[model samples]
Target: MLRRLALTAVVSLAVLSAAAPGAAAASGPLPLPSPLPLTLPLPLPQGEDDARTRLTVTVSEAGDPSAEGIFELECAPVGGDHPAAEPACDRLAELADEGTDPFAPVPRGAMCTQQFGGPATARITGTWRARHIDAVFSRADGCEISRWNNLRPVLPGVR
Candidate 1:
């Protein structure tokens, strides 16, 4: 029968394996990857930090361009036309130190409260930490409200 043939083959394989346990090792050792070299960052040039953290923020209500307000922000030395430049820069620096990306959007399929915040929206464009950033923000829902609140002065005070 087919069952007998399968059982005989299984027993044969078991006997062969038990008879030569070291046969597998005779193929030789496997090649291992070499360890990578460690690298350290060099010091930043003078004025480099100041040059890397500049942004333009534009806020509007209900998608109305007429109501939009635009402002420039420069960190490091913290000079700009923003109403709360120092506070905004300080908050942004705190985020960077904590390894948080303020411009990240809400994750898909995330559970959030159904409450609506408002129709206010904002756009931030420019460079931060030497990387280009162009992010849009809105207080349209609970998740968005939390995101906006976390940025504080960087986005603008809105309820």
Candidate 2:
């Protein structure tokens, strides 16, 4: 009787352990890829002798890459004695004009260029922002951009 009881307990434990993982996985939606944060230092407008101002730029892809995905850019000033205290956050529709479906994954090395300042010739920076900048491939539902990890002190130099 003792031997039979021990064998039954062991078999029950094995089955429960094997089924636990699958049951948990099916209980909820799959996880999504983590967001990426990129920090950039904006140079003081030319001729201004003030110290450089730090602007943190975070890029996050909304739930799947669709024409309706909300791509947000947030700029916050760090350190330095600047009057710009309000952090600017802007949300633009991803591929608004292309009419492309959003469910598709963003192409590898997808390039996006944003220009600052007024009309006429301005400083043109190449490869300013690119999707999958880290070359990480993720098949999750959506992407997000936040200051969760990439925070650092501002340094003197052009980013």
Candidate 3:
């Protein structure tokens, strides 16, 4: 009887351990072997002056070769700058719809470009606002991941 009890306990422990989360070995990194580069275009605010800024972003899986690309971004100031303590920038998805192409598949080993629009107003300085824009590109054949934005100011000495 003691032998049977011991055997049952061992089986139950093994079953419980296997049921635990993350119990299985991890699959290695994503299958993709290279990074995806992107670019963005910026827009200026109405009646306000703005210029295009170039941006580069590379997205790759762990243990994969880095892929890179350059793009343009446009932005303008509409609302005056807010308190430094609070982030003055917020991502506007509706703006992205104006100029940006919906996600499309890319050819393997080839690069493609797409444009996207941004918010109508962004705070540049205390009580100042600006317009914004973006452009994105990626290699063909990769999955269409989600979109992202970088609202941090690029101007020097402008916190």
Among these predicted structures, which one has the highest lDDT? 1
Residues 103-137 of candidate 2 have per-residue lDDT tens digits of: 23344543322332111111111111222112222
TM-score of each prediction: 0.65, 0.23, 0.20
Lowest-sum lDDT 10-residue window in model 2 = 149-158
Looking at model 1, the pairs that clash are: none
Better of 2 and 3 by lDDT: 3
Backbone collisions counted per model? 0, 3, 40
Worst 10 residues of 3 by lDDT: 119-128
Predicted candidate 1 versus true structure: per-residue lDDT over 1-159, tens digit per residue? 999999999999999988675665786676654422222342345656745788999998845454368989998788888878899999988777766778878776655678888889889999887878899998877878888899987876654
Q: Candidate 2: global Cα-lDDT?
A: 0.28
Query: Which candidate's TM-score is highest?
Result: 1
lDDT of 3 at 107: 31
Could you give candidate 3's per-residue lDDT for residues 13-66 as a string of tens digits? 998888664444465444754554442433445665322222222222212222
Ranking by TM-score: 1, 2, 3
